[model samples]
Target: MQRYELAAVTGLDSLTRVERDVPRPGPGQVLIRTTAWSLNYRDLLVAGGRYGPPRAGCVPLSDGVGVIEEVGAGVTRVAVGDRVAGIFMQGWIAGDIPGDAGNTALGGAIDGMLSEYVVLSAEGVVKVPAHLTDAEAASLPCAAVTAWNALVRESGIRAGDTVVLLGTGGVSLIALQFAKLHGATTIVTSSSDAKLDIARRLGADHTVNYRAQPDWDRAVLDITNGRGADIVVEVGGPGTFDKSLAALRPGGHLPLIGVLTGVNGAVSTAAILRKHIRVHGIYVGSREMFDEMNRAIAASGLRPPVDRNFGFDDARAAYEHLERAAHAGKVTLTR
Candidate 1:
């Protein structure tokens, strides 16, 4: 087998390909032949050591679409030739997140999907939506599932809700899709008017050019006729969280999912107390959530927005493109 290895914590430069022995599935595990992998901002953080360092030479990708090449003893959920995708949080199978679950995140603490083949516990894999291809299915488990958990499971964003999403990144795009599927009105903000146009075409009810108006949250509030949005996919970190919170209606939901606007250190306790609000810190999702999300996606016939596709060998370039924020949707790499 061949795998990308982190020779050192040298930013994305550390990831390089090398030959390796084909890994055998241990008991309760299955070996997947990776066909497509997707890049996220988290992958950039992990590669640069900001998130954390992986074991040396570890394969580094969280979300993937692959075919089951073999199933080990005790595995019953999947078998050889099954089209599947790995759940990034391998151990978050059901219920609440356990202390042990955080330690098993793919592409970081453990080996990831940037390989020709990988052995993963059968419990961490889910059957891909039948309507999707390898590249499309590869985009789901991380960003799509996280967004679904935020809207459907945590935030309770439903039909007739006015929801706000920050930026045109993967999570926000997926959340936008789900929000529409649930009949919610969606708003998006983007640095580029061009990207905002694309987002509008994808069912966004309105768009704010954040570059022209740094205070995009106000636009969201104004667009909602002062009632504010029912939910905000708060991905902009500290810089935008307070404003995103302000842009929400009293008792609305705020699911903080990213740090693109930088970390928030202090906040107004009084404001939170005065206005009833619910905020959740989303970290992808569990295997069960992925399964539920797949059902919704399949039934709705929703496809993740693909910004661009990179050759599997040019994984580093994919990360670079994402870092530059040059794409309108999910960046993918195909084997």
Candidate 2:
């Protein structure tokens, strides 16, 4: 089998493709014939040494979908020929995240799904929605699960509530879809009018081109007739954190999920206190949340946007595309 591993944590050049022997499943494990994969911003961080220093020879992706080609002794959660995706946090099946959960994370803490075949604990995988294509199913484990965790599982989003999305990236676009799935009015912000148009077509009630209107928060207020949005999917980190807060209603829900605009910056602590904002720091999610989201996806027939697809061999090009921020939704790699 062939896989791409981070030979060094310098940049995209570090993704070195190499050959390896396919391993067999041991007790309670499954050997997956991975067919497709997707890139998250976190992948770039791991590649560039921004997230943290990864171990040498670390495989570089957390999101992938495949068929169980073989199963080991006592394995019952999944079987051969089952289509499943590895959960982002391997040990976080349900409830609160464990203190050592990071140690079990794919790509960062362990070998991930960049290879043609992978061995995973049967307990850490979930069957994906059948309606989704391989690329779409592969996109779910990280970005989509985070969106689901933020909107449905935690926020209690309901009809007529307003949601503000930061950019037309994977998480934001998926959040826009899921928010609409629950009947919430969505407002999406992007620097590109073209991307905002795409968001509008995806059921966004209103779109704000942040490049044209620098104070996009005020636009959200105007759209809601002075009542701010009920939820803000805060993906911009400290760079846009204050504006995200300003865009929200009093007692609104804010899921702090991304750091696309760099990690550190000044924050307006008083506004959070004054508005009674509920800021939830969300990672990807537990496997239980992934199952619930998959059920909703299957019911609604939701199709996540795939902005681009690359051949598996062109993994470097896929990473470059995502790094350039040219794509509107998930960028995928397929066999």
Candidate 3:
């Protein structure tokens, strides 16, 4: 079997391909023949040693879709030939996230799906929506699940509510789709007009270019006739936090999902208090959430956008492309 591993967490150059024996399933595990993989911003952080030092020589990707080749003793959740995607946190099967969930995360805490084959707990995999292609299914495990967890699960978003999205990244684009799916009025912001046009085609009701309109919060207010948005999908960190707050209605919800901007800076607690806003920090999601999300996706026949695809051998170039941050949707690799 062929696999890519990080020789060291220096950068994309650290990813090196090597030969390995195809792994067999252990008790309660399933052996998967990985077919496709997707990249997220977190992958960049992990590759650059910014998401904490990953285990030496570990495969470096959390999102992938594959077929079950075999199942271990007592395993019954899925069978051979089942197409499935591994959940981000293998330990977080249901309910709230466990304290040790971080230890079970793929790519960082464990060998991930960047290999031709992988063995994971039978309980950790979910069936892929039949309508989705391999690359689209692979894109769901992290970014799509996080978007569902934020807008659907956490915010309880409903029809007629105004939802604000930070940018046209994976999560934001997916959030735009979900918010529109639920009949919400969607507002999207980007630095690029071309991306905003894409967002509009994806059902964004209004768009803002933060570069042209530095006070985008005021733009949000103007769009909503000063009532403000009911929910803000806050992906930008400290740099946009204040604006996110300013753009929200009193008692609005903000699901803080990413730190695309710098991670730390001063924030105004007074603004939060004054607005009575609820800020929820979203990690990816539990397996149960993934299941619910898959059901919704399958029923709606919604396809996630694939910005680009690379051959398996071009994995390093894929990483570099993500680092450049020009792609509007998920970047994927196919075997």
Give the alpha-carbon lDDT of every model. Answer: 0.87, 0.94, 0.92
Q: After superposition, which runs of candidate 3 have C-alpha atoms over 4 Å from their true positions?
A: none
Candidate 2 or 1, higher lDDT:
2
- lDDT string for model 1 (33-126, tens) is 9899998888887777777644667678898889999999999888899999989888899898887776899988888898999899999899
Model 2 lDDT tens row, 176-273 = 99999999999999999899888999999899999999999999999999989999999999989999899999999999999998888999999999
Give TM per candidate: 0.98, 0.99, 0.98
Please report, as a residue range, the 10-residue window in candidate 3 with the lowest summed lDDT: 47-56
RMSD (Cα, Å) for all candidates, in order, is 1.1, 0.8, 0.9
Error of 2 at 34 (Å): 0.4
**How far in Å is the alpha carbon of 156 misplaced in model 1?**
1.0
How displaced is residue 262 in candidate 1, in Å?
3.0
**Per-residue lDDT over 1-335 for candidate 3, one digit per residue giving the tens place of the 0 to 100 score:** 99999898878878999999999999999999999999999998888788865566879899988999999999988999999999999999999889889899999988888999999999999999999999999999999999999999999999999999988988899889999999999999999999898898898899999999989999999999999999999899999999999999999999998889888989999999999999998989999999999999999999998889999999989988888878888899999
Which whole-number lDDT from 0 to 100 does residue 159 have in model 3?
A: 97
Q: Name the top lDDT candidate.
A: 2
